[model samples]
Every structure is written in structure tokens, then in C-alpha cells.
Target chain A: MRNLFFFIYRFRAFLIFLSLEVLCVFMLVRYNTYQGAAIFNSATTYVGYVLEFQSSVKDYFRLASINNTLATENAALRAELMKYKDIEQTDSLNKMTDSLYVVTDSAKALPYILHAARVINNSIRRTNNYLTLSVGSEAGVRPEMGVITPGGIVGRVKTVGKRYSTVTSILHSQMLVSAKIKRDNTSGTIRWTGGDYRTALLDFVPLHIKPAIGDTVVTSGYSTVFPEGVMIGTISSVEREPDKSFYTIEVKLAVDFAQLSYVYVVEDPHREEREKLERDAGIKSDEP
Target chain B: MNRKFGFINIVQFVLFVSFQILFMDSLILYSTAFCFIYVGFLLFLPLGISRVWILLLGFITGFTVDVFYDTMGIHAAASVLLTYLRPHILNLLTPRDGYDTSDTATIYAMGWRWFLAYAVILILMHHAAVFFLEVISFRDVWYTLLKIVTSTIYTCLVMVIIQLLFFSGKRANR
Candidate 1:
């Protein structure tokens, strides 16, 4: 007993260190799996509601721009109505209404993102930055949806509440967005360099991809977090090494985070069904 | 007597943890605030406190910061290590029996040189461990090393500033 106590006392610090590290590793491993993912879902929804309430006050200022966008969309809709009438005058009225209703309902079924949120709690200064949006689950905000401003991609939903949701911004070091260059078919990953909020680094593009400065970068839609063809940023600079395999590209962000007042969260109504099918097919969704 | 200090220390721990998670954490300016306050905790440890309590305090301090940051157990691991090493540091600076029982470890009790030496070593160790674990999450060895050095420098500077601001006063001799 004396020898055992002596041995333990001599290495107590080491034992504590080992035990704590092991505990942390265990927690980290557990958190990375699906079991813990659902645990955050409820808390996220409650927090989202609170965040949305806080943001509504700031979002009032962006009403003019949002109104103008809605007005423009209305005018475009009217023009399309006229074009449809001219193209299909001989169709039966009942059939026309049914078809038109189906198309509109189907568009709505695509999960029309309705709420515009203002960022009240923003964190562009961290290695893993999270943005708080003022819209919540009560306003139809859900987890795994995409949030973007007219400027560009903001981030995807991490947690949702009745009135607010938290977004993991693209500026985070852990955030990875599937992006492709406009001029070429080649694609790569976009990740932040852990310092600048207005720029990101593109990785994995091959030397043969032929990228240049001013090339537009857009979402590749390889992941469900965002739809295909959404603008991400533009390549501001490119550094090609004499003996390297990939070009180091610097991208200028499209969103003016400093001036940001409002944003739209995109919701895919078919997300659950699509996810189920994908999982059944042994495919995993790339989420950050 | 120790129990009374323990209650005050718990309050301090909670305050620092809350400030780190809810306020400074929101600023997102590199999460430097937590790193700053962590040094402050080390500085505030009363002279003659048991070695086990020091390590335990360090563990709690680090674990609190980690829970909010969502980095799992990295802070806790580093903090426990810091606590484990604190006694060795205290021994180097002041003989075990030389320090006043009621006197706090302040810049006034130990000269600026000893205080700075102790603070720098502990802060660097904490920062190095944190950055290494965080960077290694993705398996980038060289990148992690660069982060360790740079972040350690930043954390060390902030720790020094915090020490200068809060713990510089001399306590009455016991």
C-alpha cells in the first residue's frame, strides 16, 4: 500500500494530465458523431428566436433595399405573365390555371426563404467565427439551410431557434465551401486563412486549371449547405510557383460585412427527403 | 481560511469564464481575451496555496473557456498542465517557506523581474499547448508550429498587459 501510494503521489500531475487529455479526446470523438448533433438542435432553435428579436430592430433600415428588390421582381413577374399569355392563348383556361398553380406551388415547395435577417452579433475576428442572424425557427429558419446577402454567400445554418439562428461564416478556418472558377471547369475548396475577414484562400486547384486574377468564384453545389451557382467571391490575386502543383489564389469577398444590414436565408423544402435518399445510397453530405 | 478564499476564487472563475464566453468572445478578435484572463487567474493565486488546488484551479479555468469556444477539451488539457507546472515555477522564484502566508503573488511581492519570468513561462506554455492542439485537428504540422509561436507571442503580450493592470499592488505584510 505504501509503495502504491508513493508511486501515485510521485506521478499525480502526470496522471491528471493524461486523464484530462483522454477525457477531452473522448468528448471530441463523441461530438463529431451524429448523436451529439441532435442535442444542439433544440438549444439552437431557442437561441435563434432570441437572436431574431434582437436583429429586427436593425433590419428596419434595410427595408428600402428589400422593397426595391421586391418591386423589381414584381415587374419581372408581370412581364413574364404577358409573355405566357401571348405564347399560350389557345390553351384551356382550367388546364392553364392548374399548370400555373402547380408550377408556383412547386417553386414554393423548393422552400422559399422568406425572412430577411440582420446580423446583430457578428464575429469576424475569430479563427472559427459565428454570425448571429435575427431570424429564428419560428420564422421558418431551419438548420442546414444557406444564408447569403445580396453581396455574396454569408454562411449556412448551424443552430436555429424561434427567432434566430447562428451561421458559421466562411471566414472561419474550419469552414470549407465548394467553389469553382468561372473560366474553367476545374474546382477546389475555399477556406479562410484565420486572419482576414474580407478574403479567403482557395485550395486543391491543379496547376493545369489555368486560373488568373479577376476570375469569378461561385458555389459548386457539391454540398447541400448551398445551392449551385451562388456567387462566392472574385479572385483578387494569384500566385503561381515555378515548381508547384497548385496556384495560390486570393479571393476578394463580395459581402461588405462592415456595411451588412440584412440577409436572406435559403431553405430547401426537399432537404429532408433528399438527405434520406443520399444516406440510403451510402453518400455523405459535406458540412462545415 | 482556505475555504473562504475558495468561494471568492470560484466567483472570480465564473466571472472570467462568462466574460470570455459571452462578451469578449463575441468580438471574435482572435479569442485573445480568454488567453488574457487565463494569465490573470494564475497571477491571482494566493501565496502558499496547495499545489493540488493550483492545478485544480487551472483545470477548472481552462475547462470553462473550452466549453464555450466549442474546442472540446483543448483548453482543459493545457490548463491542467499549467497548474501542474506552477509549483515548480513558484519554487524557482521564491523558496517554499520564504513567501508570506497571507501575501498574494503580485508584482509588488516579487520584483518585476521574477514576476515577469514566471508569467512569461506559464503563458507561453499555455498558449503553445492550445495552438498545437487546435492546429493539429486538421493534421497540419508546420502550420500548427507557426501558429504556436505567433499565438504564444500574442497571448504573452496580453498576459503582461493584464498583470500590469490588475495585480500590481502590494499587500500589507502578514
Candidate 2:
């Protein structure tokens, strides 16, 4: 025992350094993985509170722009409401003239639910950026739910807290959003090449599709996370690689990430049903 | 380790950690370089303190910053390595009269040339470890290296200005 103690004392500095560094690296690897990301992200209590406080202070500076956005959205909704009201009034008038006539399907207009959230902390410089929002599990936010703005798709929920949630922003290299060309409906995947936040790479698009520059790209609904037809970006450039079969396409993202302050968490009602059908189909195919 | 100096060290630790998280952290200059001045606290530990205790102090300071940065342990890992290497580095630069432990390891006490070399070396090691782990991929090796270099220079500049502002060699000799 004395020998062991002496040995440790002799090499105490190197030993201590090794252990501490090992512990730190261990924490880095453990938290950087997909599973334990929730506990270490900024959505935790103290940092959450501080960032929320800072955002609240900054939120006051941008109230005018926020109000403008709200007013524009309200105007669009009101216009749509007027059109719907005209149709409903016409239907009701016809129903009064002929008894037993009924109006159906208005209650099921949307397949997903949207919850409004304020982004408390946002980072755009990192290759894999994330945003912390004031909404969380208590607000019905959950992992894998799609997050978007009034303008375009944002990202998916990575981890949820009681009062906050972290979103793996679209700028992340690992993020793969199912995207399609609005004109031709040709599908591709949106990926970041770790350089530009305003631009992203569209993968798996064929050379023959011939997407014109400025073509609109939107979510294709292949993944249950995002409902179909949400705007992603507009094509900025396209190139056909001689060595590869697919076209190299670039997209200019619609949402200005630097100014991102508000988002809507999208809850897909039929996501579980769709995933279950796919799983059961896979099992049946495996039986052969 | 007189009780008075120990108490002063405790106060410095809190001040350094708070400065790092509150001020340095919020400055993301050009979206690449992040100046971390807290590492200066580890480098300037009272002379003759046990190397093991220095490592622990570095971890504690780094962990305080990490909790706010949400970087898990990247800062702590780099800090431990830098703190453990400080003694050997001082020995490498030992003057014939040897290190005067009377004054704290302030830039003013250590002379501008010696202190600049020391600060630059330690800051480079810390920044390299931090940015390498931060990017975590060799695919963008040049970019990560650029970030490391810029952040190190930025940190060293901040340390020099801080030392000139508050601490002076004449005062440290007391």
C-alpha cells in the first residue's frame, strides 16, 4: 500500500491530468450522442432562465416588426375566413330551402396541430446549430415534431424540457428534410454542407429533372415529422456532376435564420399511424 | 498558500469564471473566434501550488463556463491539459535566477516578452483542443485551424489588456 501511494505521489500531476481530461472527453462523447443530448443542452433550467431573460429584453426592441408580422398573418387569415364564410352562408341558405342538407369536412381541414413558441436562444454559426424555445413538453412539444416559422420550415425537436425544448436546426449537417420541387414534384433531401447558413445542398435530385434556378422547394411529406407542402427554400444553383448520376443543387433557405425569433411546433396527428403501417409492412416483407 | 492569498484566489476564480461566461461568451466575433479569458486564471495560479490541485482548479473553472456554454466538457478537457503543462513550460523558460514566486505570475511581473511567449503557447494549446473537439471532424481541417489560431490570438490580446488594466508588476512585488 505504501509503494502504491508513493508511486501515485511520484506521478500525481500526470495522473491527475489524465483522469480529469479522460473524464471531460467521456462527458463530451456521452452528451454529443443522440441519446443524452437533452440534459446538457441550453434548455436546462439556469441557462434557460438567463437566455429567456435576455430574449425578453431583446423582444421588446422588435415589437414593431413582430406586430407587423402578426398583422399580415391576421389579414391573410381574415381574408380566408371571409371566403369560407361566403361558402358556409351559401350552403346554409341552400340547407334552409331543402331540409336534411348538411355541411361536412370543415372540422377536418388540417391534419396537424400547430403551437406557437418564442425562440429564446439561437445559434447559426456552428455547423450543427440548435435553437432553444420557450415551449416544451408542457406545451405539447415532443421529440421529432416539426418546427417551422410562418415563412418556412425550421427544424425538428431534438430534446424537450418542462418549460423549454431544443431544436436541431436545419443548419445541422445531420438534418435531412424531405424536400421536393414545387413545379415538377421531383423529390430530394435538404442537407447542409457546413459552410453557409443561408444555403443548403439538395441531394438525390436526378440530372434529368432540370430544375430551373429560383424554383421553389418545399417539404414533400415523405417523413411524418413535417406535413406536406411547407416551403423549404428556392433553388439557387444546379450542376450535373460528370462522375455521379444526380444533379448537384443548391437552395437559398427562405427563413432568415439570423432574425428567427418565433416558430410554430407542428404536431402531426397521423404520424404514428403512418409509421406503424410502414413498420408492419416491413415485417411482412421480411417474412418472405 | 497563506490563508489570505488563498482567499484572494477564491475570489479571483469566481471573478474569472463570471467574466468568461457573462462577457467573453456573448462575444462571437465574426462567428468564428470565441475569446476565452478564464484560462488565464489557470495559467497564473500562485507559484509552487501542487500540480494536481492546479488541474482540479482548472476543471472547476472550466466546468463553470461549460455549464453556461452547453459544451458539455470540451472547455474542461482543454483547461486540464493546459494547467498540467504549465509547470513544465515555466521550467523550459526558467531564467538563471529561477522563477521569483514572490509576485503572482502577472505579465508585468514576468516581463512583456517572456509573458507574451508563455501566454501565446498556453492559449494555443487550449484553443486547439477546444476547436478540434468543437468541429470534431477533420473534413474542415483548415477552417478549424483558422478558428483555433484566431481564437488564441484573440484570447491572448484580451489577457494582455486585462493585465495592463488592473494588475501591475510594481504592485505584485509587494
Candidate 3:
């Protein structure tokens, strides 16, 4: 017994080192799983407050550009709203407002809810990138909800605190967005393989589709995370390796991740119902 | 260490950690080289501090940095490895007359040559561990290697400049 105690005492430092390292690895694996709520992330109250304060101080320099972007977006939205209003007026003049039409329109209006939030912290240089937003559970932000800028799709909420949340950015290695070529509607998975923050790879695009450079890519809405037709990016390069059956296409992302300030967290109201129905029907629901 | 030195070390720890997360976190050069100046705090700890204490400090420091970076354990793992190897690295670079009991691992106390060797070796190990652990694969080995080399150079240059500007003056007064 004394020999055992001596052995342990002699190697206490090594033992401590090993145990600490193991604990870190365990945390890494545990917290990295999709949608897992981690207690120690940047969204924690104190860290979020510090980051919020720092970004607030830095936001003064970005005010002009942010104003310009918001102005342009407002102009675009006004034009879209005008078009919709004209259509509504024409429909009313035609007297085609049936009960079924009203039902469908109301159903469509409630599919997704948007909450505007400011990005307090964002990182694109890391292999697995994440963004911390200034809105969280108190503001109705929840894990698995989609986040998007006015320009393009951003990422999904991974964890939420009282007034803060962390998003697994589209640049993350494990993140997969179901996207389709806007021209042909051919669908594939978008994955970022590190290095460049501005680009990602669109996988499983078959050879016959013949995708070209500058072809717009948008979310396929195959999953409940994003609404149909949200902009992702445009294809920049397409290559066909001899051994592979799929085309390796690179996409230049639309939203500049580095300059992200304001975004909308998208919550699908029918996600639970759809998921439950699919689950009961024995459908796998693979896309996320 | 005296109470004054202990208090100074505590202050330095806070400064290093805050500076790292607030300023250095976003200060990447050319989207490739990252300056992790917090490692400087670990590298300059008093030589005679217990290894167990050093290990705990390393874990705490790295874990704190990790929390802000949103990489929960990668920093902690790399930092623990760095602290675990610090004593051996110091032993390997022991000067001809051996280390003074009062010595801290500052460039002002150790000569430039010794300090450079020590810093480069330990920082290289730390960066390699961090980048590889982050990537978790051999697919992008070359790119990861480039990041490791560039970040090591970047961190070492910053650490040296900080030592020259701050620690050198303090040592002269002593």
C-alpha cells in the first residue's frame, strides 16, 4: 500500500497533466456536437457582456457602411412591397379572394418568424467558425434556428443564453447547407473545407448538370432550418475529377462574414409539427 | 518568489489574457498568421514554480481564452501540453553555469540566444498542437503546417518586442 502511494506521489504531476488533457478532450468532443448546449461558450453572461462592450466601442467606425447597406436593403424591400401591393390590388379587382386563398396566404405568412439581432462577436479564421449574437432566449432565439443576413444565409444557432447566442457559422467544417443551383434547381450539399472564408464547396453535383461559373446557388429548403430560395452564393469554379462521379464546385459566399453586423434569426413555426410527422411516418429527414 | 513578484505575476496574467481575447483575437495577419500573445505569459513564468501549479495555471489560462474564442478545449489541451514540456525544455537549454534560483524566464535575465531557442521550441510545439488539434485531420497538412510556422514567427516576434519594451526596463531598475 505504501509502495502504491509512493508511486502515485512520484508521478503526481504527470497524472495531473494526463487527467487535465483528457478532460479538455472530453469537453471538446461533447460540446462540439451539433445543437449541444455548452456552459462555457462565449454566450455565457460575463463573456457576452465583455464582447458586447468591445464591439460597441468598435461599432463607431462601421456606422457609415452599415447605414449604406441598410439604406439599400430598405430600398429593395420597398420595391418588393410595392410589387406585392399591386398584385393584391389586381386580385381584389378580379374578385378572386376565395376562402381557400385566404387560408393559404395566412399559412404562408406564418411559416417563418424573423428576429433582428446584432452580431457582437464573429470569427472566420478558425477551422470551425462561430458567431455570437446580442439576442438569445429572452428574445426568442433558440438552437437549430437559422440565422441570415439581408444579403445571404449565415448559419444556425447552436446554443442560447438569456441575452446571447452562438451560431455555428457556414464556414464551419461540419456545417452542411442544402443548396440548389438557381438556374437548373439541381440540389447538392454546401461544405466549407477551411482556408478561405469567402468560399465553400458544393458537393454531390452530378456531372450531367454542367454547372457554370457565376451560377447563383440558393438554399433548397429541403430541411426545416432555412426557408426556400434564400441566397447562398454563386459558383466560382467547377471541376470533374476522373475518379469521382460528382462535380467539385466552389461557391463564393454572398455575405461578407467579416463585416457582419446585423442579422435575422429565422424560426420555423411548423418545424416541430413537420419533424414529428416525419418521425412518425418513419422518414429519416437527413438534411440539416 | 516574494509577495511583490507574486502580485506582479498575477497582474501580468490578467493583462495577457485580456489583451489576447480583446485585441489579439481579431489581429490576424494576411488571414494566415495569428498572434497568440497569451503564450508569452506561460513562457515567462518563474522558473522555480511548482510544475503542478504551472499545469493548473496553464489549464486555467487556456480554458479562459478558449471560452472567449468559442473553442472550448483546443486551447486548454495545447496549453497543458506546453506547460508540461516547459520544465524539460528549460532543462535542455540550461546555460553553462546553470539557472539562477532568482531567475524568471525573461529574455532580460536569460540571454537572447537562450531565450530565442526556448521560445521558438515551446511556441512551435504549442502551435503545432493547437492547429493540428483544430483541424483534426491530415488532409490539409501543408496548409496547417504553413499556419503553424507563420503563427509561431508572429507570436515569437511580438513576445520579444514586449519583453524588450517592458521587462528590460524593470530588470535594469532591479
Candidate 4:
């Protein structure tokens, strides 16, 4: 600071002259009738002309904090939405609670528990495609729980880790779900030949059912893998082989695999007990 | 011991400021040329006054004229600039015999030729700064320049006449 004073003193006359000149310039612009407006107009345009400048400035500075807060809120909202969504998608028939009827059926209206998770990694190009999720063992997501999007069925939980989980997406060649035609209750197995994301193959529907285009196919609830009435898609096209009695079904998939963002893990807490009882009773059904 | 020179300097500073603001400000010629005899105060400052004091005195004198003329800092800025340039002008006009600090810068003391050159240069630079700042644009630079030159000569003429009337015989010749 002392050095600054010395340096200033050395050039004091010129510095003083320069300062006075600057002061004069400022006053001239500030008070001059003609130039004042011109100067301010130019200055405002040069500095303030950027559209959304106020929001950009505020957003730029607080973006990180805002992002973190929004992320947390979104997580909470998604979890709540997924819970309600699980209730919305599950068959109202299966969730029935009537005290008048004695409990006699094994599939007795088991409540579905839902946990929201985001797709961390996914593949639709492979013959055997798998979807990775953000939730893992820490989120109570285990192997074999069904994962689904808001549109329709996604896949079953294949594996679980502390930080993430993988779902076998329905687009995989090996993935097959027991699905039924809502129009006639004709049950069939839905599969993917593994090329397109929009269509899946529905096999084993008998020719007598006469399924039409745009008929919604839903889960048959024949297996414990998925609950009844979860939408798979609609029948897009039907073809018949010259020798076969079954219809070759092409289903327009409801869930767009290419644009998948979030999925929910559907949990039935009584699934293990019911499967154990079924095994003990030797009531084995086609497991696929 | 030279109370006479100090008293004349004060009188010159006050009278030059008042006369320039009162009579000269309204004396605008050609909508561009303006009389700016306030520069005469800076011109009459004692030779070899430290550049800092010269600049300060210049700013004060011009600021005084600015208050009356309502030109804000225009006169002050020009005055300060001319004040800093004074030493170079004096050095350029210095005779081969060198300058006598005690002699002062009146025409009688320094000779009419040296005094005119010194005063004219300072007045020209001051007028140039003042008018250019007042207009604050270069759109009519040639016209502004004409005003600067004309005002410079008019200021020099007034200063020289003042010098003749104020300084003569014994004191300047001493």
C-alpha cells in the first residue's frame, strides 16, 4: 500500500489530470441532455440485452443447489407416485377384500408393494436385453420381483446389488410372460424375437379365439412372476401358418423400450409362502 | 520576500476565473468557438512550481470557472491537462541562456516572443481539451478543431494585452 502511494505520488500530476478528465466525462454523460439518454440506452442494450439474463444469472449461481433439491423432491414424488401407480395398475379383482367369502383360493388378493427406481443402464439391441436400475439390495429390491413402467410391463428383477439392480426387459428373446387376450380371455405366452422395440410375439393362442387387431393383451396371472391384468400391449397383426392351429401374433408393445426412463419393482410379500405351499402340494404348473 | 509577485498571482487567479466565466462564457461565436480565458490562470502560474501544485491549482481555477459556466468538469479537466503539459511547453520555449525562476513568466520579464510561445501553446492545448470534451464526439472534428484554434488565438491576444497592461518598466525589467 505504501508502495502504491509512492508510485501514485511519482505520477501525481498526470494521475490527477487523468482522474479529473474521467470525472468530467462521467458528469458529461450523466447530465448532458442529449448524450445522457444516448449513453444510458447504449449501456442498457450492451449489458441488459441478453434475453432471460436475470433468470440465467440466478440459475447459473444457484443451479447446483437447485439441482440437488429438485433431485431429492423428484425422488420423493416418484416414490409416492410409484406406490399409487402400483395400486392403479394391479387388477382390482386380485386386490379384492371381501369378508363374506371364506379364504379358499391361493391367489387371494395379495397387496403389491412398489419401490421406485430409475433406469441406470439398458439395452434393447441385444438378443438378450437386460435393464439396470438405480435401486438395489439397500432399497429392498430382490431377485424375481417384476419391474414395470407406467405404460406396461418392463421385466422381472434378474439380479440385485447394494447400489443397483438389473431387470430382464421384456424385449429379450428369452423373456416370456403369460398373457391373455382381454377380448376373449384367450391366454397365450408373449415373447420377443429381439429386433424391434415396438412389437413382441404372442404365441399359443388357438385359431378358434379369433383375436382382432387392437385387442389389449394383459397378464394372465397363471404364474407368480407377474400379477393379473398388467397391460403388455395390443395385438397389432395376426397371421396363421398353413399347417398350424395356433395364431402367430404380433403385439404392439405398450412400453416404449427406447425411451424408458423409470420403472417400479412390484413386490408381493406372500409370494414365497404361496410358492412353498404349491410345491408341497405337488400342484406344479408350466413354469416359464 | 517577493510579496508583490505572490499578490499579483492571487489577483491574476481570481480575476482570470471571474472574467472568463462572466464575460467569455456567453461570448460563444459560430455555435462552436468559445472564449476560454480561464486557461490564462494556468499559464500565469510560477515557472518550476512542482507539477503536482500546478495541476492542483489548474483544477481549482478551472473548477471555479465551471461552477459559473455550468460546464461541470469540462474546464477542470482541460485545466489539469494543460497544467501537466506546462513544464514541457516551458522547456521547449526555454532560451539558450536558460530560465530564471525568480523572473516569472510575464512578457516584460521573459521577452514577448518567449512568453507568447509559452502562453499560446498552453492556451491551445487547454482550448482543445475543453471543446473536444464539451462536444465529446468526433463527428464534426474539423469544425471543433477550427473553434479550438480560433479560441486559442483569441485567448492569447487577451493574455498578451493583460501582460502589457499589468507588467512594465521596473518590475518586469528587474
lDDT of 2 by residue, B1-174 (tens): 211337767877888877775556358688678788888788667867777778888898887777666577988898888888888887887767887656467777778888888889989999998888777778789888888888888899988898899786676776
Candidate 2 per-residue lDDT over residues A1-288, each given as its tens digit: 999999999998899898898999898887656542357567776777877987887779898988888788789989999999899977756566556745575325546899999988777776667888998788888888999987899998877878888888998867888889999999988988776689999999988788999999999978878878999999999998899999999999999888887899999877777679888887422110
Cα error, candidate 3, residue A101 (Å): 3.5
Tens-digit lDDT track of model 3 for A1-288: 999999999998999999999999998888887465548898899999999998998888999988898999999999999999999887765564554434555448776899999999999888899999999899988899999988999999999988899999999988999999999999999999998899999999998888999999999988888989999999999999999999999999999998998999999998888788888999846668
Please list all clashing residue pairs in model 3, or write none if there are none: none
- Could you say which candidate leads in lDDT? 3
Candidate 1 ranges beyond 4 A from true positions: A1-13, A32-111, A114-121, A132-143, A159-166, A182-186, A204-210, A242-246, A256-263, A281-288, B1-8, B22-35, B137-174
**Candidate 1's DockQ:** 0.34
Write one digit per residue (lDDT tens) for candidate 3, span B26-132.
79988789999999889888887788899999999999999999998999999999999998998898889887765678777777898999999999999999999
Candidate 4 structure quality by residue, lDDT tens digits, A99-153: 3555676456557888987664554643345665667677888777888765689
Residue B146 of candidate 4: its Cα lDDT?
77
Error of 3 at B4 (Å): 8.1
Q: What are the lDDT scores of the predictions, listed in order?
A: 0.67, 0.81, 0.90, 0.71
DockQ of 2: 0.60
TM-score of each: 0.75, 0.88, 0.96, 0.42
Count of clashes, each model: 14, 0, 0, 0
Residue A192 local lDDT, model 2: 85
Candidate 3 CAPRI classification by DockQ: high
Structure candidate 4, residue pairs in collision: none
